[model samples]
Structures are given as structure tokens and as C-alpha cells.
Target: MAVGARLTPDVLELDPAAATDRIVAELRTIVGKTLRRRGAVLGISGGIDSSVTCALCARAFGPERVLGVLAPETDSETETLRLSHVVVSTFGVPYVVENITPILAAARCYERRDETVRELVPAFTSGWKLKVVLPDVVGNDLYRVLFLVVESPDGRQERHRLTAEQSLAIVAATNFKQRTRKMIEYYHADRLNYAVAGTPNRLEYDQGFFVKNGDGAADVKPIAHLYKTQVYRLAEYLGVPEEIRVRPPTTDTYSLPQSQEEFFFSLPYQKLDLCLYAHNHGLRAEAVADAVELSVADVERVFRDIEQKRRTTRSLHMSSRLVEPVAEIDLSDA
Candidate 1:
């Protein structure tokens, strides 16, 4: 409930020109002084965060020093792959195409996900893509239920409540995607002695919209402090392809295309970004509702939902806890 009350309206909408300069400079500093690495490596998902992250890396380290790895699996959207290449070509960054379908198949991620989906919707077939969503939990509600939303090739959609077990199975399965991608990113980074760059914008990072030790793992998160709207503005200024720029935010992790809203957030990114900022700034729900044109109840729901997400996903922000030190190592040893 207390994310702090900071009046940061100007931070919500960025001046791309100034941002580019500051980010690029900060990137150079982080890369040169902090990471002690020659270059940076990242997975290019063709999303706004990935696009802007790569662009900043290119500016800081040059296209040659930035390696964009395109790791796509069977469930990934075609446009995501297509636009990934666009980003690499636009930035003239060196890249490698690594199809991860075989790896995912080996891991049985899709099979596990399918079995769980069929448990809920017996008619679920190969043509169906499933997305799990959680309803708003607010105001000391101890229990929060999860839901499963699926789409078929014929454009039919279904939504139903999911048992905790069903949700866990699906998540445990699909999470392999993020972990696998991170593995590939690290492989390349290790070979090149480069730091693994993270692509989470402020909204995703604050809301815990990443997987633990998966997409959540990064050597450096250059855009972790910028909101979603700011990331888009930076994308446009960085010359991200117009098609990619205008593409609606999506998970792109499922067989059927799904927007980020249907999968997670209740409101659109722009509105959500403002609401989140306002909430963080200690604005009352009624004031935020008037600003974003929603009812006070709805705004309060969003605020509480934000709190719920931050609470549940808190562990993803942490390192693995150890009960005790293996050997009381000294800090000066390193």
C-alpha cells in the first residue's frame, strides 16, 4: 500500500532526445565501470523494452559490440520473430538466430502446459493458446483466485476459474520459455565476455511482470526506471520500425496472439502507467479516478491490484536465500 509518494509527473512522459542522451551516457558508464565487460548481449523479442534496450546498447557500445540474439520457439508469434530481425538490421547490430523449439520440446514445456489446459477445458486442442490471469485482490482479502483464458484458431475465447494446482502447472511449464531464453542469452554473453542486458521497463519491473531467475535475471537493467509510455517514446526516437512501434503490447508467448491487458493488467498501458504513477505519488483513488476517467471504485481496485502484484512477486526481485554461509568468506576476498 505504500510504494512511496513521489511527485514525478514529468517522468511519466519522457523527452526522447534528453532520455536518449542520458541513457546512452549512463549505459556507457555502467558498461565500462560497473560490468567491466567489452560489450552487451540481450534477447531480442521485438517488444518495446527489447527494442529500446538494444538501441541504447548500440548507442553506448556500438552495433558491433552489441549482440542481439533472436530466440524463438513454436509458440512465439511470427511478427515477434519478423520484427526482431527488423530491430537487428535497423541497429546494424551483430545477431544470431537460435530456434528454441527443439529445446522447449525437450523440456516438455508445451506438453505440460497442454495437459494442464485440457484439465480445465477438455476440448482444448493444439490450436488453442492459453493465458492465465488473476483477478483483483484488494483491502486485506487473504485469498486471491486465478483464472484461465484460452483462445482457439476459430477466434473463440473462453474464461474460467482455475484451481491453484492447474495454474501452477501451466506457469511451471510456460516459465521454461523465459528461463530458456535467458540461458541462451547468457551462453552468448559468456562467450563474448559481455554483460547480459535486461529489457524490463519500469512498469514491468515495478509490477513484477518477469520470471524469477528467468527473464527477471539480468546483469544490467538500463530501462528499469522508465515507465512503459517513456519506453515507447524512446523506441520511436531510437528509430524502432514503425510497425514494431505501433504493435500492441503482447505476451507473444502463446500460440494465439494475446495483448498484455488480457493476460495481466486491467487497463491499457498508457492509462495503467499514469494510474501507477499517481498511486505511487500518494494520490487518492478518487483523484486518480477523475484523472483517468474511471470510477473511484475502479481506481481503488487498480491501486489494490498493484499492491497485490507487488506483494506476490516480491520474491522474484530477490536472490535465493541461504540459511547459512558455506564458508564465512570475507568481503575483501573478491
Candidate 2:
């Protein structure tokens, strides 16, 4: 996928009020059609996406019928839980916290100490050169340090060596937390006879910055169509807590709560979106920079990142052979 394909500003320029109206209408239709006999279940992540989703759900189906699940892992921040509560209270919805820490801990302990590393080595070594392995490891560690320092002012350097096995184990453990939350979401949604509502925005979705089956699992997405800025607008409209709206967005996966911009790329969402828009319209990198009021080098860098992400997304979707084609079936004959 070229940067010029999906980053058009025209496509990104959506009318906020119309979009909200459309979202609310579509959500109501989805709930009416899918959960007419029961109700709707939404995994509330306490982020803008989920907050906006909860507000829309409350407006569409009423708070009583919309159940909010706070599926936090052991490492999830206290803020996540607090924000989840704020959303529930604001919407006056029934909420529950199903801590998956026990499940994750059990899963981690169930496997042998080196199991994950043993499994990952083959995949890692397949295309990796033996000579570059140590360097790659060092580079990753350095990047982690930089990330930590940026997110946490008090982060200290603690030299710790890791075997390849240990490194892989750490990676797997972090990934498990995300997958476990999704499992809980699925199970609870089924048990409660409600739809699983995914909380991903257009920016993340377009960037393909989500775990496919993990946080991406949802039956209905109330905020998927909105961009980050647009979500903020909706959040304000819905009276989301001031802290939540103002605080930087983070995944809170690591020890430090890293902002999405810091982890992804340093480019602000508005500028990134504008650059993307120019690029998607077949503008050259220099032209995009000029159009978006960014440096030429910055534009080039963002364009490259966008291109890379598009490729990764395409590879993931195509590899799974899960690209559902648009159907143009006609019922006139019937």
C-alpha cells in the first residue's frame, strides 16, 4: 500500500456532527438487530474510544442494557480502572471488573520457564543473521531505555542481561496480557448474551497499531470511525472526565505508561493526518511537507512509517487470507 493510497485528507475530513449522528444511528441499529432479545456488552478500556463508545451505547440502548466490563490485567494501571469507573458512573451503566491477573499468572506458570523462548527462537532465527543477533538485542534494549526515560521522569538505568530465552519470555508475557483480556471479553460477552464492542479509533486502525484478535476483537465499534481528535470532541460532548480528555493516551503495557505518540512516532496526530492526506493524494514528500507545514525530512520519515505500516497490515490481512471482499449480490431476481 502506498502512502498515497489511504492518506487522502478528503477521506479523513469527516463532518463531526454528521459522523456522530451516523455512529449513534448505526449503533442503535446494530444493538436492535443483534441484541434485540438480550443486550449489548462492551469492554470498557477507559480510553477515549471506549469512553465514547459507552456514551453512545447509553444514548442508543440506555445504561441498563449496556454492560461495561473492566478487564484489566495485573500490569494495567490504576488510572485505567479509575477511568473505567468514571465512564460507568457518568453513563450510569452496570459495570464489573474481572481481573485477569490470576488467569495470566496461571498461564505463565503453567508453561516451563523456557517454553516461550524455545518456541520463538526458530521464528526469530529464520531470517536473522547470527552475527547481528546480539546487536539487535542491544538495540532493542537501548530503545526500551529511551522509551522508558521519555515516559517516566524518574526511570533509572539498571543493567540487566537477558538470554535470548529470557528476552522472548518477556515479549510473550506482555503479549499474553493483551490476549488474556480479549479472551475474557469474548467469554463474558457470550455469557452475558451481548455483543463484544471493540474500542479502536481510525488513527490506530489506519496505522494498524492494534493486536488483531486481542484488543481488536469486538462485535460493534462505536468509535472506530472517529479519529483521535474527533474522539476527543465526542468525549467532551459526552462529558468524559477532564483528566481523561487532557491526559496523554497510553497503552500502559510496559512498566512506564508510554504515550501513543512517543511509542509510535513523534509526529502529532493532526500533522500526521494532514501529511497522510497530502501523501495519499499523490503529493511528493516535499510537497506533503509544504502542504502540512512540516519539515521535508519529517514528512519523508512519516511517509516511510506510514508506508511500512500499510505493508505490515496488508501482509497480516493477506497472510490470514481473511480479506472479505465486497459483495455486489442482487436480489432483484428473487
In order, the Cα lDDT scores of the candidates are: 0.84, 0.65
Find the candidate with the highest TM-score and give its number. Answer: 1
lDDT of 1 by residue, 44-102 (tens): 99888999999999999999999999999988888888999999999999999999899
| Per-residue lDDT over 1-334 for candidate 2, one digit per residue giving the tens place of the 0 to 100 score | 3544333344455566777678878887776764552556778777877888888887777788888988876557888898889889989989889988788778863243224433434332212211001221111323222211211133333223355556545545566766777887777677877777778887777777676677766677777657676787778877888877887777776544556776564566767767656656677776555545666666776777677678867643332443664468543442
Least lDDT summed over 10 consecutive residues: which range in candidate 1?
Answer: 1-10
Error of 1 at 263 (Å): 1.1
Judged by lDDT, which candidate is best? 1
TM-score versus the correct structure, for each prediction? 0.89, 0.73
* Residue runs of model 2 more than 4 Å from their true location after superposition: 1-15, 34-37, 109-155, 158-169, 286-293, 315-334
